[model samples]
Target: MTEIHPTAIVEDGAVIGENVRIGPYSIVGPDVKLADGVTLEAHVAVAGHTSIGAGSHIFPFASIGHKPQDLKFAGEVTELIIGANNQIREHVTMNPGTEGGGGVTRVGDNCLFMVGAHVGHDCQVGNHAILANNATLAGHVELADFVILGGLSAVRQWSRIGTGAIVGGMTGVEFDVIPYGSVIGDRARLAGLNLIGLKRKNLPREQIHALRAAYRALFENEEGTLRSRAEALAAEQSDQPLVKTVTDFILEKDDRRFCTPRSED
Candidate 1:
């Protein structure tokens, strides 16, 4: 049986699964659904056509499943789909999608949205990602698996953050971050490979080494061209998984929002 506080307002059409808990003063809107073991702390509001997966916990004052803030939103039926085991901390906000940019905002499993983090409409956030305090993702953003956005960082609309990428604190990212790479500062130049993160993820030492070499070749070498270096490395280290990953990332990047290397003066 679901446990809902007396002060909580759960609309008629809302579905609350077994063992779900709705805390004091919370509101579950008409089109909302909370799966088994989901918990919403005090003052949380879940609106629109939203579904929270099992074992997810939303902290106090979090406002999720809100309508898109986009001016293009026309009261259409959009959705916010959050996967299991996500931890949404206090004051966080996640908005649903708009018709112009699909009709759903999706967040995968085992992610963490820290305090004051905001995920704008039409964003696709992958599994095991972390949005630190005040990290904001604008509409139409895509964060691949294992990506981390540090505190106060903001990613622009239509940008893609590749798998295992890390954006440093207070950075302003206007471009797509490369897979397994790190970006930092105002314009968010590519810092280097996320060595610490890769190591923590238990990637093999040989793979890490190969990736380090590939990073230097693509970003630090005299050639200063990612395509040619990536191609050569892929050919030379065909058997290595890291080399293949690098090759795939460089070749598959969408032109709109790719990270820029620092100018060599």
Candidate 2:
């Protein structure tokens, strides 16, 4: 049985699953679909063609599935697909994709969007990711699984944060962060590997050590261009899956520059 507050406005065509609870003054649009166990607290607005999966809890004042902020968007049909078990805190905003941006924004399961965090149009956020308070992701940014955006960190449009990376608070990330990388400072520069994150994941000590070695080989080697060195290192470490992930990330083509360690480090 769904529990809807008297003040809530669930449009006629909105699909509310069993055990869903919509709080006071919340609005669920006609095209919206709330899966089982969804809880929308007071003053939430779920609009557009949004589909939120099961067991997700949205706090008060969240604005989800809104129109894209892009100037090129002329009310074209787009969608926002959020997976299960997410915690969307107060004042968070998630926008739908624009026609030019593949017409969909996808968010994976178990993510946390903290207070005031904003996920822009066309962003793709992976499972177990955390966007801390006021963390902002510009349009088309891709956050791989286990990535953490610290408080007030801002990622530039089209930047990809690889798996297990961490962006420090108040930093501006303008490049693609490599797997397991840790970055800090305004106009963010890579600091080092996310050793803490790696440990938390309980990766084997040997694998962690090899990933570190692979990282240095790609970034610190001076014998040749970084790309050539990455290729060579990839071949040498072909047996190590973790090393392959790092090397493949470095070699992957993208418009954004790869995040490199600070010169002072």
Candidate 3:
């Protein structure tokens, strides 16, 4: 049986699964569905056509699935879909999608969103990602699996944070971050591969070595253009998985700006 506090308002169309808990002064809006083992702490507001997966816990004062904050939002039928085992901390705000950006904001499983984190409309966050306290992602941001954003970091709209990348605290990211790299500061600088993170994930030593070499060739080598150096390195280290990751990252650039090291020329 579900346990709901007396002061909470669960709309008629809201579906609460077995073992779910709704706390005091919370509002579960119409068309919202909470799967089994979900819990909403006090003063939470879950609105719109939102669905929370099993074992997801939302802390107190969190506002989720609200209408997109974009000025162009026209009340279209958008949705916010959050996967299972996510830890949404206190005072967090996650908005639903907008018509301009495909109409859905999706958060994958086992992610941790710390206090005061904000995920704006149309964002797609992958599994095992961590958004630290006060980290903010603007509309249409894409965070790949295992990406970590430090406290107070802000990513601009339409930016893509690659898999395993780390954004340092208080950084302002306006471009696509390379996979396995680290970025820091206002105009973010590429601080090389996230070697420690890769090791913790059990990636082999050879792969790490290849990645370190590739990173040096692309960013540190003064021999040629980044693309040319990457191509040359790939010719010699084609078998390395890290080489492939680096090649794919360089080739995947479209309109998104990437931070490059400051050249004296």
**lDDT for every model?**
0.90, 0.93, 0.89
lDDT of 1 by residue, 1-265 (tens): 7899999999999988999999999999999999999999999999999999999999999999988899889899999999999999999999999999899999999999999999999999999999999999999999999999999999999888988999999999987777898999887999888888999989889889988887877777877456667678878888988778767777775344457577431
Query: How high is the lDDT of residue 201 in model 2?
Result: 87
> What TM value does model 3 have?
0.94
Who is ahead in lDDT, 1 or 2?
A: 2
In terms of lDDT, which candidate is stronger, 2 or 3? 2
Top TM-score model = 2
Model 2, 1-265: lDDT tens per residue? 8899999999999999999999999999999999999999999999999999999999999999989889999999999999999999999999999998999999999999999999999999999999999999999999999999999999999999999999999999988898999999888988999999999989899999999888888788777766777789889999998888888887887333777874421
What is candidate 2's CA lDDT for residue 241?
A: 84
Tell me how far the alpha carbon of residue 37 in candidate 3 is from the true structure, in angstroms, after superposition.
0.9
Give me candidate 2's TM-score against the actual structure.
Answer: 0.97
Task: Give residue 44's error in model 1 in angstroms.
Answer: 0.5
Clashes of each: 1, 0, 0
Per TM-score, what order, best first?
Answer: 2, 1, 3
Question: What TM-score goes with each of the models?
Answer: 0.95, 0.97, 0.94
